[model samples]
Target chain A: MRMDKEVVNPIIDTILGSITSGLNSLQASMEPYLPELSWVAYLAFAIYVLIILAGGFMSILCRNLVRAMMGLVLTFLGVAGMYLLLASPFLAFMQLLIYVGAVCVLIFFAIMLTRNVSDGEEAHWPTLGALGYGLLALLAPLGVIGPLIIMHAGKIPVQVPVENPTGELGEGLLSDYVLPFELISIILLVAMAGAVYLAFRGFGPEKSKRHSK
Target chain B: MTTLTFFLLASLLLLAIGLAGLITRRTLVGMLISVELMLNGAGLSIVAAYKSTAASDVLGQLATLFVMGLAAAEATLVLAMILVVHRRFGKVTTKEISLLR
Candidate 1:
């Protein structure tokens, strides 16, 4: 009394097809509201933005240089998160890998080598009157430029449609921007050599002096 | 409500804070940290622009990769300079290294 294999196969196929159709219809119904998804995207963007700002504020306000570096690292991470929200996961990954992983380490090493972190002396370089003048000088440009930028904001076009921009970017870089790219590499190599030479110059004398001290 | 506006505001705030740090901080390392903050702010803006306009997978990413490379190279050079300054002066305080005057 067992059902034929052919009958069972048809029954299974029908069941699976019906389930798929149901899911497809559900997705189709949801398609009309796709633009609303931008709200969620906006929220994610806002949160990351806040994180970055907060980190920047901390970096500035903190008295300890090490704490300031930590804040900078946090800011970089927040920016990376924002990159992810912007749909540039590749940039986000590179941000983490290069800035957080390498640059921060270099900053820390420099801090360790250069500063006596435990020393409690103030590090201000300018007299109060000079600092006041400097602040005024700095603020003057912002006062002039800020309003101009704000007023012109409405006139600026904000949106540009990119067609598979990442792919196009690769093509553009390899094809059109190739020379600049190569030049950047050469500059980096020069910088690397210069840094090595500068760092090695007085290390021996300084180390011996420190040992004798 | 727009991601673009949100990101723009964030970058602006970041830039402002970094600028403040650069102006006020007396330690070379602190100024360097502030510069890093400013760079990150710039990078965020670029990524946001790419994401909104290009809607592409890799273009924004590639730009950021270049930024990262540049940041690394910059950091290495700056850190080396900082170390050299420290060795020559026996201190990294901005106050102590003003021999040019």
Candidate 2:
């Protein structure tokens, strides 16, 4: 492994060097207009948007369920970056820990458990007719109407964003939103119990014995 | 476009994509994934709304926290239900499990 890494390291370094150099050249060329670290934020935002779009499209259109889950994971990560851009690092971390970490793993497990069930089912890719219908059904109307509304609507005046609201968020959760906070815990507990029960409801001793015969 | 506008538009797009997926997906798990996308869109829009309209208010962050909690719970329950359905019906696709019809 060490020898392989030694051989591959130079190639990886060369690729990375070229990419960074290319970006630097592009930034230098655009320096007069963009001029500073602001463009980096925009670049990051654009990358996140691309990830979201690609991941969402892949999740919807992919034939493989596991690949679809991976796409969903990408969407989660992109949304976490969006949260960071929105000045909420706490929620961004939660998005990473819960959505990408926990939820995606859970979905992966479900995919593994149910693999045989989906094998011979109507699990094919959407045909061109279905794709066209889906586009017409949702995308066309939303695409046409969404821009019209946004263009006509008066913009909400932007305020100076809070630099860090996580502390205030905690205080509010403890004081103003305490009830809902506690309720969420209870809901999670109930869900956990319910899920376990639902999954193993029929695996009683007698049923297991019957199946064994 | 302004950051606020960009987020709103992106969230709207996410919603439309999610809904389209929900309509077009053939598997129960795929539908669950679509619902998650819709929820993320809702969370982003909420945070963006609060960021632009009420920068100091912690309500938006709190609401998003609640959303994440609910999403975790929903994923748990839905995946479990999917397992049950697969066990009982021996299939996990939408078209194959129609017992009533």
Candidate 3:
């Protein structure tokens, strides 16, 4: 009893056809879920935007230096949230750790140390007109450049498969970016030293005067 | 529309406001607050770029780490300086501190 070739070929073909059709339907059923995902993304984005704007406004309008620092913290938090939406959890964590935790704390301490809480004299310059002009100047260029860049971006070819980006980033930093990194470190060191020197300058004289008085 | 773009824009706005404050504020503490705002903006932009590119470069994360380290150092030093300045001048306003003349 030999099996005929024609019979086996049809059976194999039928089975393969059924499997392909099943996969196709499965994909079809999954398509409806994409919009929901997009909507969630949009909602997260809107919230982040609001956070950034509110923070910015607070930093600008608050007269008290401490209040301004609080606003800055809010801004940082909002930015970190945006980072999470962007899909880089590592960066978001860094933002929270550095900007909110360390930097803001430093600003708060600086405010406490320098500000005379009981003194009622204002600490800000009256530059409303100049500030408005500066704001307009900064925003106008961004507004123009943003649209132009967005329009041109569609025609630009996006580099695909960024070629082991993490590895490349490290290599690039150690190799190509080494000079800039070192320079930045030097600058930071200088800033640190300069600030210390400036702060210490009048300390001895001021102490003597206070004691003599 | 993209998450990265949105974040970048937000950071830019923050930076702009910070710059304005830094320029217009006359107190040492007010300047420090402006600096904090600027730093926050930079952090946000880095995170957004990392997230949208979908590339696991982790460079943005590393950069943020460095920024934090710098911020800590900066805060300690700046606060100490502010304390000393206040003690010497009896006031922290930038205008009042200009006694060199």
Among these predictions, the greatest lDDT belongs to 2
lDDT of each: 0.69, 0.81, 0.65
Task: Output the lDDT of residue B13, model 3.
Answer: 71
The better candidate by TM-score, 2 or 3, is 2
True contacts kept of each: 0.52, 0.60, 0.41
The TM-scores, one per candidate, come to 0.73, 0.81, 0.67
Q: Estimate, for each residue in A90-209, the C-alpha lDDT of model 1 and write its tens digit.
A: 566778888888888898887778753535222334567645754654465456545554555434334522334446666767986678678779878988999999988766667777
lDDT of model 2 at residue A151? 85
lDDT by residue (A124-196, candidate 3, tens digit) is 4457785776577457646865665445432322221122335555676688668757765786787678777
What residue runs in model 2 are displaced by over 4 Å at the alpha carbon? A1-37, A116-123, A152-154, A205-213
Native-referenced TM-scores of chain A, all candidate models: 0.64, 0.71, 0.62
**Compared with the true structure, what per-residue lDDT tens digits does model 2 show for residues A1-213?**
356877899999999999878888887887654424354677887998999999999888777777788889889989998888877888899999989988888888878888822443436867788777777656764777578647844455655346565678788989989999999999999999999999888787777775676
User: How far in Å is the alpha carbon of B83 misplaced in model 1?
Assistant: 1.0
Off by over 4 Å in 3: A1-37, A116-131, A137-141, A152-213, B54-56, B98-101
The candidate with the higher TM-score, 1 or 2, is 2
Interface RMSD of each: 4.2, 2.8, 4.7
Ranking of all candidate structures by their DockQ, best first: 2, 1, 3
Worst 10 residues of 3 chain B by lDDT: B1-10
